[model samples]
Target chain A: MLFKGIAASHGIAIGPAFLLKVEELRHARRTLIDSSESEEEILRFRDAIISVKHDLENIADSMGDVVEGRQILEFLLLLLQDPTIKKEVENKIRCDKVNAEYAVSSTLLDVMDKFNIMKDPYIRERVADVKDVGRRIIEKLTGTEKDALNNLKQPVVLVARDLDPSETAGLKPGQVLAFVTDMGGKTSHTTILARALGIPAVVGLQKITVEIHPQDLIIVDGIHGCVIVNPTEKELSYYAEIREQFQEAESLLQQANPGPALTEDGVRYELAANIELPHEVEMVKSLAADGIGLFRTEFLRLIQEKGENEEDHFDIYNKMALDMLPKPVIIRTYDMGGDKFRTGLNSAREANPFLGYRAVRIGLDRPEEFSIQLRAILRASIHGNIKLMFPMVTHVEQLRSLLDLIKLVKNDLRVKAIPFDENMQVGIMVETPATVIALDLMLPYVDFVSIGTNDLTQYTLAVDRGNPKVAYLYDSFHPAVLRQIDTVVRLCHAQQKWVGVCGSMAANPLAVPLLIGFGVDELSVAPSLIPDVKKMIAVVTTHAAREMAEKSLSIETGLRVRALVHSYVIGKYPEILLDENDWKTGG
Target chain B: MIEKKITVPNKLGIHARPAALIVRAAVEFDCDVWVESPADKVNAKSIMGVMTLAASGGTLITVSAQGDQEETAVETVVEVIRSGFGEEMI
Candidate 1:
């Protein structure tokens, strides 16, 4: 059986399935204890708490600097030490004459209920922590404590409904071949960890947990987001060869220089990284990126319950600017809405969210909130090279109003005697078709423009990329999308403004040549893709790439454009393609 | 008894970490400390009590204390809550 899902992390893994089921704690029901036995019941609960704490401390000691894991353990430890929980449970054991396990479970359930009713989603999520603590205590009391994740005897393909960050953190390297979860998206925590660890992952399978059985043979194709169950002998050999080739390609890419990103014919372009968080700055440095092409600010909003304040934004941008000194860090303002976060003020479901209020629309609608970010970016500008970029600008008026707002913010900073870079370059992302057609008008107000191909493709083709039914229509290589990018790049160049592509297109092996051929000043991709992109750049000549791009634009469809680039690249750099068969089918 | 009014400071409010910090801070003084929100009041020295207050980022709350070091306890507990629990703040 073959199942498809979102290709979260890239690779292939073949192993026996290890189905992770969330087991409910089984503890004795409420039994009236003898009045004389109340003391013993209380003592039992205390002993169980102590044992759970000790076990958690052991896990914490072994977990070195995994932030999410440490937080979980710390929370659990604190909950155990909570005077109210212990007092409440002991009171129940004594006054209600209930058994120790029953008292503990009941008390913890009350706490979980309180958390569940909390208006704040972040607080509500804490019910998981309470449940975890309760399970550990109940298990300790019943002598049923089982460390399922740690007892893995061999490598297996881990399948689950969905993995919490704590569970993913408990994963021992090389013990799990891949992660196939029934829930999660491209930016889910599991996906992020899988990428960081270079493990194959396929998420949002919806029914994989129900379909998969323990010890069943499974093949996880992270590259194509496919899972093959109980594969035939011929299929096994086929994947084995592909997996070997993938590993070979990865090692080869790793050996390549991080880069000057110069084409064979002497065209130099900056190769940068698009990072979502501050920690990824380290990865960006290791890759020796020219700079950060896109520093997504949405993650901060998503993490912080009340949305990030100016100080939070300033601290991050300041540190990032200081760290990547001399290299530019283009921080894109929070691109919220549209499958991302909905503003606290207006979270009502939009019929067409992608086409509705989002990004710059939210910024303009809430100037007070938008200015907080603008203030932080301007303040951080003095620390290091930091550039501000706005997302989803569809018209000259939006650009004009945004520029006007910036001027007001700058004046406000001046009045307050705050030190900021007066000359900080401000730019906007050209992702809308309206912006692409009106590039000449918008160019005069901005310092530079970065073509965001992902949204551009979605908007240009009128396809919601996240909707499975229309996802097939979402392709950045489409001639219509390609023509808009070419036009934007040409307009930016004609006006002597810098231009770069920061979307997935920048990292795609097939799209790299066409972008380079379009004379993109920079290519900012995920840090892991930098080496691979640089290798591709070294093998392609500007003269030939330009010819390919020209031919690609004249092509009628995205498939042919892709085919044109694919054949051109394979002929020039055959090693870059995983294999002829995989490339031919557009894997 | 001494009482002081303050707002929850952290962006995430009194979640587990902040509640733990508040409880840790409250247990230091030789006095009874209690925090009262619009909905409920809880023992400042109890992590569960502090968390159950469910005081979101901007919710105003009152911290009151009695017994030895009453003034200092109220001030310290109120200060901790006001400090945004050392979380990311302006």
Candidate 2:
């Protein structure tokens, strides 16, 4: 029987299934106690936990983003604070019945058992979390440590049921060629880590242990999430050709890196990246982005406990604007509704967060906070080309209210003799169906409009992205979604306002041609995906894209639109086409 | 000890939170605190002085302190400006 899973991480390795069975854990625990003797064992156990704490801290320090690392450190700190575990060992010492090592082992078993019995998957996963903490502690105690990957003599493809952030962090790029896991979703830490490391990984292969034999010849395609076992020569040759084509295409994209994203007909389109943090400025520069298309400012508000002040907003925005200098940066003011802002501020628990008081609505409600941000933005504008964009504007009244606030803030600045850009360009993100319908009314008020397809598609289809059952219905290519996008783009263009798209759909190669045809002036995507999307855009003529968009819009079914776009893109640029077998095989 | 007044260059001003970040850095040394703006002058350690400065981002004010760490405190406040008051993304 053949089973396929989403290949999230990339690389191919054929190795015997070294299933990390629960029984090995049982053996290791049993051995831990059997080998220990006397009161000296408690000292050893304490030393072990201490060493693990140090190791965890070191790992956290080495990570690029301290957020996840800090989380793991906090977890370790909690484990050390576990009164039950501490008391058990102390009781053993006082009773003169068992050694410290035995006490520690028994306490660990109790904690692990509790974690395993948790009904919540997240809680149950904590069992591995405990084990990982245990392994680090034990390694420190026993002094029988394996060198950190640099000591590995032979390269191995790591196969795990699943890997946590801590475990994945310890993997060395040289020792691990690739990874395959039996479980993990696309946004799982395993997938993110794999992408960051540029390693190929396949995840969510349920019951892979049964099908994959140890030492089976397996070819893994990380991009398409395919794994081939004992492939025929024909299959190997086919993959080889595909691999060569991909490399050539990659090289071509690299050559185009220093060049502008212009079509064969010489129409240049602005290519920018959407960013969540100030740190991402480096990534945009590396991609040679025109500038930040959308800087989601809410991340700052989320990271801090209190509300963000104007100085904080100004400082960050000013720094980003100055850093990106010359390149125009469009900052979408805090789009903090939905899951993003629920934790703090006036954010209330809403049944439908996407449609609730968010973006400009919330900004308008709290003029003081909004003015602080606006003033900082205004102040930062003097440093570089910075534009302000409000998200989730549904009506002309909302736009007008926001514009009035901007004018008021500008006037206030002028009265204070504070220097600011008098004519800063302001824009709105047309994300809601209401906003799409009222584009003509809004067109005259704003400088430009960016179509946020992610939310737009979700709202159009009335499907929550978080709900797995209905997630498939949230299609960007849906006729309704496309029609809204097209209307907004066309209307904006007619009114001489520039329009762009900053959504997952914008980066999608299949949607690029259609977007171009829809008269999208810019495509803002993840920095890493920019080159590939640019390459796709370079091959297709504006004429072809328009034709494809026209065909796509007339289609009644979302799948048909997707299929048409896929075929249109592949027909024009076969090199950019993802391998079907690789996509299906769960490599 | 030489004392200099510097307004909170940060948009947030010397409020409780940015005040917390500032005071935490201040307590690392031994110094007497005072801050003054056009409107008022008050104890630097006094959260009130920082607040009264009403130093929103880009506001100009003065900072002064005394002790062996006086120069250090004054310089540190000035450094916040050079670094954009910890807002500068490196």
**Maximum-TM-score candidate:** 1
Model 1: how far is B32 from its true place, Å? 41
Q: Calculate each model's fnat, 2 decimals.
A: 0.71, 0.00
**Every model: Cα RMSD to truth:** 15.2, 20.2
Docking class of 1: acceptable
Given the true complex, what DockQ would model 1 score?
0.43
DockQ of 2: 0.01
Cα lDDT listed for each candidate:
0.81, 0.66
In the predicted model 1, the residue pairs found to clash are: none
lDDT tens digits, residues A247-324, model 2?
A: 566566756766678875778888987776676688678778888998877666744456667778888988999899
Worst 10 residues of 1 chain A by lDDT: A578-587
